[model samples]
Target: MRVRLKICGAVLAASVLVGSALHASSKPRENVTNASDRDYPAAKLSTLRGKIAYSPGVHAHSLWVMSFDGSHRRQITHAGAHADFDPDWSPDGKNIVFRTERGRYDSNNTGAQGIFVVNTKTLRERQIQPRTGGLFPAWAPNGKRIAFTGLNPTCCGEVIVTSKPDGSDKRIVKLPTAAGECLAWSPDSTKLAFCGHQGDGNWAVWVMNADGSNPHQLTHPRAIEPAGTGGDSPSAWSPDGKQIIYWSWQPAGGELFVVNSDGSDAHQLTHWDGGDEATNWL
Candidate 1:
């Protein structure tokens, strides 16, 4: 509960680009810090390759694509007043599924959010068929389904839900805590990693089978003092499916952390200012 409240306070006001870092199986690797979320020098931008999809804005976030080095940035979605975020590219790199607060309502009487898909090349965007309510959409590597935190009243509250890309055949991946968020699928698509409250009432990384079985906690970051707070929010898995990257918070600040897929060798990866987040692994 403390961490959940902190999550709300620490949210970036504008937007954040996904940061990438080198990864290895031997140990936790250092993260490559980006100069600025809004600007990258042309010389530096040319040195990096690949594309990154992110939601960029202060009041109204919308999906955008840019090179890994921050070059050739292009808008992908023009949702105007609606906020679009949590862009997850399909494994094949053809489409992206993300959450949009366009035309839905939540339990709090505020506008609810739902997932929508857009073709990376054509820029055509449409809401997922059959309709679904959720945030932080993650595409399974097998290219069959998208997993996200649910908002449907039938879910009873926030929980992990998986459904076809078109939003049909939905299935809830029940968590022991009854609430969860930030779902990431294993590279092999056999398991899911997410963030949820532990028995101690602190948020921690948790993993479960793709079918929603064998749930277990993976990290146990603790608050330094009684009044402080600690928690871990999983971002994504390494390419080989051997490790997971996440964000850990303590009284001092937040940092990136890495742990083995089997819940071993949990350690910090970044030592910079707190608030360092682990996004796409690249």
Candidate 2:
């Protein structure tokens, strides 16, 4: 259900064979610990950046973490059958939130896949709800609530929803996105930055009240596909809740961008020869 950006072994081999054909690049970033970055906003909680967690080679796999320079590569969770995807760190940096799916698909699912929590230190894992349908869990800055995408049977489409860490008091925050839409908790925990589709059929970054009110669209990019691939992306909230980092696609493929929380002063952050994804703040 979740959009998978990782390369498949088959695709990886082909990409390497044609690496020079689709070359891209990234622009210089001013600061790694600035207000626009997500990690800095959570510094008040002293959360550790910890390891760079991701899938090893494909979408249907376990979670992995690596050192800053890609050394010490290790798989942290051994989730089988249910593929582990969408790894997010708790505000305090002690635990991680992820979803387990039965098959490979975009990050969104129809409530069959469930959200889970794992303690980074002990590797202990548990589901917040024994049987729930959700994916792409965004841990709240205050460490009390979480936001994710789940099925809305009434609309027969996916809707944004939130619940306590214990999976109680669930509330729906309806928005326009099918799947692959990600949620980011504002540093203040009152608002959330997410991706939604625009009238033009392209995905754009958006912000909304965490309680499911006052939803607003922020970014407006011409989707290269000219149809819509999930609209522009709203990846993660800046540590200060002032801006967001998201990914966009062009003829050259996907690149990363950062925009003000109010949808102003957007700037390109990367021009990678391949592509970039919004993961941890860094």
Candidate 3:
């Protein structure tokens, strides 16, 4: 009876349209035929910007990777029903860390919720934290560790934890609150940015030092929407580590926004009337 709650704030607006028909051997059992499969036009950037990895499938989660200019689009996993989502590229761009569910949503649930790594060059896959119910994997800038949200099934929620790339030395960085998730490692790897409920009873973005020290609130709880509006969610940091990008669903629509790491200078980045949610800076 372990219910799966969609990881808030990780969903992107793009559709999951598989570019090529090359399928993987461990493909999950789900229908992606109706998924919107379109690739972003690739463009060249002057610097070696990093790629943005996200799950784009509307019905069934699918993992996709795109360059900073939306070029070099590729699908890293084809786990149909398992719903491979929340992809994070390795710091070196050689692999991706992601999550997947096994079997259909209703029947034959493997409880196979864990963090996995996929080789970008050869399309090889391996489980890094098998059956641990881990998600939102963020690789430390130093490339020695990965921070992710590990669900405590008995506790009915999740917490942030870090481990070596090989799944060794796993340690949970307990949050002040039990509900914190969506970890984003700072560029210097000294802190982790996440979203959680503060003592004020609303969801706001917060940050903590690498060892879970100095838990500071970044966004004011009052920044939340009025009743019936969607809540704010955790998001990615700019390459320079000066700002973070998140989505806020107001009365008009959901839009991407940037805020200083210290919770100052919050401003909108996209003006799509319909809405724009996912944003990652290279």
Candidate 4:
């Protein structure tokens, strides 16, 4: 059996309440289209700055947004058992694109997970249909496209998929790796950063062109004895697009690291013996 582990970034001093509804859809794959003519209305930058959105739960994960100082906390999605996570803020900061598990957690179950968008202000939610299913949905900084990782039926591995906010004109990027997840786009929207399951029997941080060209590994983390599995999962990029932040798993614990865009000059940012990761950058 293949077990999947989900680790959310660190947030401090916040209270959460559950019980809200977001539109849930189990739509067929045929709903995904090949046309690119749909036009999304342009959005303006939100005046509300320095706000953070995250999903945390002990029973089941739901969405939450709070101010940068950990105040004005509120729960956005209250799917009792459905795990809602991997939120990426829209360029306008008005909506958040996220992934929701339909019923149960099955990594290989096609259509088991669906991509969704939630209005941060009004709490309105809608599903974004992918060809198969969507995970780790990232809204482009330009607000023109959204990207995710999905299971490839024929190849039996994860493949990168990009589509409009409405889930039209789907395009797939087949990476030279066993599996991939936690996709993040650069500030300029020219490149993508994600966690890839390497052929060398380990996971590493990888960067590639937005169109899935010129794929390359960034960090090569070694496995320690007690932990065994070691890898790096990218979280987000800096505002200026010069650096990338990610989490490196180890026997001691997960530590945050900052690296140059070209995979040079990596340095540790945290020494805490806990799982420290950066999910979003403002």
Candidate 5:
């Protein structure tokens, strides 16, 4: 997704922190525009499954892959005319799917974009879907489909959609959220967990079958939490496919919370002074 999505309790990586350590035993190939597998001599780097790709700069936010511990940081895309954000990894860990900014936000109030997948080894890129109003791209665990957010003709409501790797056979599933512009595939890739808005003007996390049926709320959390509890963001199913892990906002700040997929045994796992957001399970 190209928009600078706002979370009730979230931190946007809107600014690029200059002077990042770009040191690498073998620097990624020099051609930032395009590359081949030979350009990425380090095959093992592409296979590193636990690394994360995220946008963390001000203008033209570029994608960066780094270890959870903040080591082996590598910047993937050169700052183009627009920024790149919301990266998702393929099941094989060989490529990353993300969105790059396109047209200016106009009267429609949405930015236009296309989803692109980058070869982790070569750093070469290809388009999965034409530049439309698409946002977060989530790869299916079964490797058969990818789920992402697309804008309605009004450039307003975002609907969840799935398509083949090549962007064919598109299907739409409906569940709405003011900030829930994302979907998380279950470990088996049969269900998705996302945020849904309430008529009362609050948001709750909801889950549904992959085909867009059986939608239900998983987080009917209290509207208030001792002057802290406020809201949650896109959620991910635990690796075991047992619980959904997500971040919620509170008076103090954002905190990570986990709840059973069936909406039972909600658990708060942290009490940091400020808060935390779960970007990905890995």
Candidate 6:
């Protein structure tokens, strides 16, 4: 079947820390009542199954997992400390990998940030990469290795490294000149998709062999820089390995979009005027 490319124009930008207080009051009284409410519009494809996990609201950094159909919603963690933002599910969907701060307001403290794993069924928690600063954790397609962004205080963003499930065999894969973030491993596990800045000061989507060879740029010349409002960016690879879904901000708010793996046929998927970011896929 030919993959249909869909790009949602609603762009959900990353939430930034406004103050020192890591934990804020929960939803307002009026908004609190709406917490249990859910509305899952039918998606074109039913094959996508897993729930979308993300940190919601302005002050609520807690992690949440909800079904694509808008049923079976649950909050996995209540860690009232620094907001837990990035959550990645294991290939088997049995465990969730994420990054969290050690204290309530220590975003700059690299020592406080590390990778952790949670058993979805048992609700048990354990630190996987203890004492090491990392973010944007992505599981390998085989569910054995995990790729994450390692931070080097002396430098900016560190190299992308894959480690064993237990935090062993940590090795860095050489990327382009810029630092890497928001990593997505291809379905076949042969290539990796990430966003990084080029020497020219523009952020663009880049692909590289899993073994760290033949790194190449995927976006066009005009969209290469950070100034352009819209263009290709980092995103997750689809299950079929034919397309990538990412967020782009144009005249409208930032929204989810899909494009061919080779960087062709870009299109929008969501049309929310307020914007919606693509957090994960089933």
TM-score to native of every candidate shown: 0.78, 0.74, 0.72, 0.78, 0.73, 0.71
State how far residue 238 of model 4 sits from its true place (Å): 1.8
Candidate 6 stretches with Cα past 4 Å from truth are: 1-49, 103-112, 153-156, 199-201, 221-232, 268-272, 279-282
Q: Which residues of candidate 4, in runs, are more than 4 Å off?
A: 1-5, 12-48, 105-112, 223-228
- Which candidate's lDDT is highest? 4
Instruction: Determine which window of 10 residues in candidate 5 has minimal summed lDDT.
Output: 13-22
- Each prediction's RMSD to truth: 6.1, 8.2, 9.0, 11.9, 9.3, 10.0
lDDT by residue (tens digit), candidate 2, 126-244: 77644546766888989898888877758666677788876788887767455435677888999987766634456667788887678778887666553655346666666667878
Supply the global lDDT for candidate 5: 0.59
Q: Where is the poorest 10-residue window by lDDT in model 2?
A: 37-46
- Candidate 4: count of backbone clashes, pairs at least 3 residues apart or interchain: 0
Clashes of 6: 16
Candidate 5 Cα errors over 4 Å, as ranges: 1-48, 67-72, 103-107, 153-156, 176-180, 198-201, 221-230
Estimate, for each residue in 131-158, the C-alpha lDDT of model 5 and write its tens digit.
Answer: 4556667788877898887765455556
Model 3 alpha-carbon miss at residue 96, Å? 0.1
Clashing pairs in 1: 105-112, 254-274, 254-275
Q: Global lDDT of each model?
A: 0.64, 0.59, 0.59, 0.64, 0.59, 0.58
Error of 2 at 225 (Å): 4.4
